[model samples]
Target chain A: MTTTEPGTAEEPGRAGPSRTQRLVMGGAVLLTVLLVGVIIGMLVRLPGQPPAPPAYDSVDVGFAQDMSIHHTQAVQMAAWERDHTTDPVLRLLATDIEDTQHGQVGRMLGWLELWGAPTMPLSGRYMTWMADAPGHDHREPGSSEPGVTQMPGMATAEELRRLRESTGPEMDVLWLQLMLRHHEGGAPMLAYAADHAQTPQVRNLAAQMLAAQTAESEYLRELLAQRGGTPLPL
Target chain B: MASGKTSKAARRNTPAPLKKNSFPWGTVTAVVVLVAMIAVIGTYVAVRSNEQQARAEALAPFTPTAQNPDPSRAIPGIVIKEYPGGSHVGPDEQVAYTESPPFGGTHDQVWAACNGVVYDTPVRSENLVHSLEHGAVWIAYHPDRVSGEALETLKSKVTVPYTVMSPYPDLDRPISLQSWGHQLKLDDANDPRIDQFIAALRLNPNTHPEPNASCQETTLFDQHNPPPYQPAPTPGTPGARAEDESVDPSRPMQTG
Candidate 1:
């Protein structure tokens, strides 16, 4: 038994590792690699680093770009109405929309400038950033032609021409109809941004826009109904 | 007990009996781990480099530098002129401009409301030129030549603020883009240079006299009933402001 004990110990020392021993060594290597990887990742994301600016394709940048374009048209329509409409109520509503949306445009444009993103979309496409958003379709419908696809609730050139030519009660009704639909169409975008934007300021702005547009929509509906004008189809 | 002792003695005597059966599993695992790590890091670096390359390519031509004060100079067939700013003319007067749609010169006291405005009818050149002084891009298209899909294409680019589009009656070209001191005429509305012009010069402080002037026309001008376009006054016509004529120092400069 004394000779067997020495032989067994000496054999293990001379021979290659056994299966269990090999497994332990492999596990040790794996653990070392994993620890190194974790350290590198932690260093990259260290809180001491200044926060990274939003990437070009980030949700915050996309929302600001798309919403700025959307609000421009609204401001244009409102500005026209504010100048031309004779009805006191319609004029008041138009003024509010003009002032609020114009200011909002300035704010969004300022954010985009700060983010170092183009004021216009680089792709010249709208709503592309909402591809993964639930219930939102960013694809242009039916027409593959580059510029034919417009955002929801945008007035056609013909419709705008008609509005420009119309006077008195006709102009009032048309403005309400158009603006009401514009508010409704933009609601979904505001909601999506509110939930998905990476920056808190963007999310807060989107939430505020959603709430204000919702309230304005109600007022628009009431005003349109009083004027016996039907809302435009979305 | 005797058989167990015999087996233990045989196992001890045969040195490296399991060595022949060993498959070098550790070496294989190490190689695989090393290769995976390289692939992960390599892929990440490649993707990041590609993104940076694409962004650089997109903005390179438009970004201004000290050597190239005006980046729009790279655009093909663009016309650059040196027109002094803050030259104001009365609404009733006309500027005898060298270019058909003058890029810059003496202009009306009032500027066209150019906050993404699309005027169905042709707007007066005097007022439109005033907008150009305020760092707005004017997209003037021939009404007859640009219709259907072509018209839509031009309108899409004007949706951003600091842009305005309207019909230019009897335009020599189908489309013409104008910033303060620049102009590019194109036969097709879908021409890529249309966007390039806008991206380079719209609201560019280096290109325009008034950098932060408001595009919104609060009081002086009426956008809905804007002044109608008329032919540029004949060069020596009475009371016409010549393109190179100096501004009247006594008159107050009109700020957009």
Candidate 2:
């Protein structure tokens, strides 16, 4: 039961729309504003926020865990050379290897901790994650068997024992041979992660590792050849 | 416009439907949701900002790599010395050196391990200088003075090979990082130049006299059991430990 005149109010002096109409229009405008605000908030946030975290078994986590283990062996082998060799060039190389790989290990552990993932892989089935990655060949490497070779580039228990016992040129040559093979073995895994890992950090780290190892591998070959030796069989 | 004479009369007779006032639940709901989103996102952004800042402060601002090997930083009073193979003194005893903890000079032919060793006790100067000859950067930190973040930085940097850190109870400065013929003294462990000094010298064969010298296991002297650091006893002084405090039992007579 309200006034229906287009330009007149029930009260004669008031020439504009009545209070009820104003309230209804204001509420409608406010509702529209709220709707628009919410739509914008969601749309704006879509790209502003961080991307979803990697899965527990994602390439990022797997690469970090496996590479950390690989780096450990490299550090250990380099330490052996540092503690046993007399050749100036070999010592220089050993120091470089030990320092570089050790730093890389620390960086990997930090990333794993940030992701809340376990530093070590579940059980001993390491490097299996790389199997399904693009261009991978070892879908079921079968490293779990008692003596089927648990890890590529890793020294055998017998070999490690002998390395500890050996010294002089015999030890120097053995260390170079073992480390060269180890770096070559790790190349495939590094390349896989560089191409497949989702996180930029993971991909970049893998690329860096690949570049460093490739260069080091070349130098190690030259050093070995200079000393009248060659890289050990894979 | 419709003249509403009929509607005016109707309003007069029935009375306008009682004017109603309702809560603005829709606007309130939108406001609450928007505020919650801001609070959560704001907190996340704040936390992330803090974490990144902390990480930046912990490490040196720039990392020197092989491509950028020299950071072009200089040591304040780096000592340089040139000594030949036969110049280092006898292996059986401590020798006199002009530098406090000799960076390089004639010392024992045998060198203490520089394979990233952190000596719990102060090592003899003569042996340590040999490590310098082999291109090892020696980092000396005082146990009582350096601790916390600065100490952590020192420890992390020394973890790399061709570096060694030891406790110097009587160091004039809190920390002294030395390579063959080069030394830098500083009071703060977080000093950016610490890593700069290391990057320029550690295994950069150009600076080392015996860049190829062995740092492996030794037969000359046990690293664990080495003579302590002390001002070498004068040649004329009574060789007895009772007469000379600097003349420890392990070190023989110091020739001037």
Cα misplacement distance, residue B38 of candidate 1 (Å): 22
Q: Model 2: which docking level applies?
A: incorrect
**How much does candidate 1 score in TM-score?**
0.68
Question: Every model's Cα RMSD, please?
Answer: 10.7, 14.6
Which residue pairs collide in model 1, if any?
A: none
Worst 10 residues of 2 chain B by lDDT: B239-248
True contacts kept of 1: 0.07
* TM-score of candidate 2 against the unseen true structure: 0.46
Winning model by TM-score:
1
lDDT (tens digit, per residue) of candidate 1 on B11-118: 667543363334356666766776777677777778888987677566545744333457799899999999888777786788887788889988887899887788
DockQ for candidate 1 = 0.13
User: Tens-digit lDDT track for model 2 on A137-220?
Assistant: 454444433211255787774676577678988888888899999999889889988988998988998899899999999998
Model 1 misses residue B119 by how many Å? Answer: 5.9
